[model samples]
Target: MPIDALVYLSMTVFSLPIAGIRMFKISSLSLSIGMSAIAAAALTACGGSDDGAASTREVALEFVAVAGHTPVQCGTLVSGLGTGSAPAQVKDLRFYISNVALLQANGTETPLTLSANDNWNLTAGANQITLIDLENATGACSNGTPATNAVIRGTVPAGNYVGIKLTMGVPFALNHTLYSDVTTAKPPLDIGAMAWSWQSGRKFTKIELTDPEGATGSWTAKTFAVHLGSTGCVGNPATGETVQCKAPNRMEARLTSFNPDQQKIALDVQALVAGNDVTKNLGGAAGCMSGGTDPECAGVFRAMAIDWKADGTGTGLPIAAGASQTIFRPIAR
Candidate 1:
């Protein structure tokens, strides 16, 4: 029942027997009690004081794979357009996005409260971060597990969010711990395909592509893995601990005009490897393994707006200064 109605009912019920008393006394007492009840009802209706608990609005961080302009899925073969462009099937697509914040019009960051669901996201401090699992173990993604997490759900202050800011890697504190030993480790870190090691840390972004040029549904296909993570770290793989990394490789994605409700962030696979030849293997492990020496790392890192050199590790310059503008784009309406 509404508080106002309840208050009125209570006042009437309590004053019924007292109605036979002196008229002025009953009126004065009723007036006093009625005023108090109305005041309490008004406070209850407004949900307490203004600063007690503000209403929260939900923001969804959605993920999708695209080749050129066509939407692609895990098992679908997407064709490229460049000289070495070849039809390739996505084997796995997963990444970690943390410390999500909403940009205010006055240049302030309001941290989002990530909904803690064991599958896709976990509690990181008071806030929440998400492990975006775009594909599961099917078709070319057979090596992966059968858990698809393509959306991140979280709550922010109810208002107009002008922009979105998120980190593309696990925080350093949570990054260095070993999932094997950690009893409370959650998804993304717990998933064997996503977690690399303590030295390398978690694969911040794992994008695996297989060339489907002449073969279909064959396991004997050449695969390329873009395993972006912390490299050049002094750590013990056995203990699952790392002191620090020479190259953090944590890419920051800032969308200046993204409204999480009205639009979604698109991680374009075509644009990410637009300059590379997905058909030909670059020797060793096929593609960039987040190594500084790997020739393929430069283009891939550059695509995400990271200033990476051929030998690995950035030039100590700011990432967004010379980063490529091809990889992360907003989804069309």
Candidate 2:
């Protein structure tokens, strides 16, 4: 049979007029082809099904801002100064915090790169990392950019991490007096305190003490730097990041050990607010001043707060004797 006759006969058998059936069939097929073409096009635009590589695992570790020298409430400020008892009492309420790490329960720590370090001071609490490099808008802090707290890029293992840790400076072997300079390509390349302090070789942090009697604080302020090693800062004094002058690699620690069963670490920010209990761990204000109180640096460093769930500033209550530091995941997370 001819092709045209076969087409007509088949349409009629299906209980439809030949011409009408033929047009409907063509239109249906055309629509089907059009739909198929669209579907294929959509798939390609969506990065080509099954042709993509492994997905990158990353989590944004955001560091929010809170004033070190005030009560540190979310928006607490006064006379261009932030509200806080201890920091307000001190000459300058700033300390450098860098070399951040995201820890896993498996003893792994992922180090964070320096996002922004404008104005060069590392010790300012609001200086290191935060949501907005929010300024005090009052005094010396006006020109400074609050450090970036959010971890924009970091390699996260495919599991729940328990804690985080990092050395205070660049690794020892890579450090020198020059490394203290944070000039991008400097030897101590990643050292925060050294560069921030400028003069101190590798200061963990600096706290000033004033011995005077007056209505307002006196001008006789004594500067104390927390350097590596012991008094007089003997034995090379850890040029790079870790605890010393001449070491090979960065210090290694397990952040998971801090967490009990995947729980968060909640620090008693209230106690810190009351006045960092410098006496509890470091004996007295005098000892911490010179690292004179031996074997307590770790204790003091441990005393530094890093909670996961608490608000960046905490409840804003004063810390008490019974208050222990709490560490947990941040609520925003």
Candidate 3:
């Protein structure tokens, strides 16, 4: 029953002369039952007010993977693509994306930590982050890593927030081998795997393109896997930690705070795989395969930013907020 209905019902049940009573104090059971009858309506009327108790808001962060589709997985869905019958399947694909950062309205950063066993908790506000999930994800790689991406939602006091900040993998500080004491001290969980080996450093992701010439045919049966991690990693002889090299491979994805009431933010993998990261700081082959000389792959690894445009569903990507996108197509720039 709604609050209005309950209120009406209570008055109707005891209608008549009883209305002369000064204070009609409600009993425990009556109060409980009456409140229960119309809780949702009451809350709606309250509209998350800060009267006796402060009202909390819940935030929903979803991930979508857009590849063959327009807007991928609403914008952050984890997935892989291929088409075939067993050996004919074009599943020879791999990539690395790490070091998550929140894109505030003004364009600041709220970096997060990712690794095998990371501390950044989705429920807690810790900078911990994880991937959503990939279809047919298996092997040691898929063992402990989260199959679901981190969600930062809760009853936060209603206020103005530009957006969130996070990263994809572990940083140099946490990359120190000394940090991995597997004795009585529990090994700190590192959320960025596939990019990290023990504690080398964050290597965002690896993009592999197979079918050399075309689909499963025409092209050679070779594979080109693009892996981005701190190269030239040297292990500390004493504590057994890997020190950071001068430069490391990385990727940066930025998205303005998606205004729930206004425009929705969308991420498209089709454009991403086909987009160009030609900025001086951002390098990568416009049409090159991975696996060659360090220099050959360096240029292709430079541009590692996934920039979502204003037109998510129409002009840019077809990704949505509630669902994720999964695709398997032969796409290129």
> Which structure among the candidates has the greatest lDDT?
1
lDDT of 2 at 86: 26
TM-score per candidate, in order? 0.77, 0.42, 0.46
| Steric clash count of candidate 2 | 40
Model 3's C-alpha root-mean-square deviation from the true structure amounts to: 12.3
TM-score, structure 1 vs. true: 0.77
Ranked candidates (lDDT, high to low): 1, 3, 2
Q: Model 2: how far is 43 from its true place, Å?
A: 19
- For model 2 the TM-score comes to 0.42
lDDT of each: 0.71, 0.33, 0.36
- lDDT (Cα) of model 2: 0.33
TM-score-sorted candidate list, best first: 1, 3, 2
Which candidate number maximizes TM-score?
1
lDDT of 1 at 106: 77
Tell me the tens digit of each residue's lDDT in model 3 across 1-333.
555455655653333445567545445467657666576567656655324555544454444434544433211322342222111122222232234444455665544333335333331234333433332332212333324442333333444556543333334444444334443112233333443553444334433333322344443334333444554456653465436453343343444445433333333333333332211112233233322232333323323332122222111112232122212211221
Better of 1 and 2 by TM-score: 1
Model 1 / residue 295 / CA error / Å: 0.7
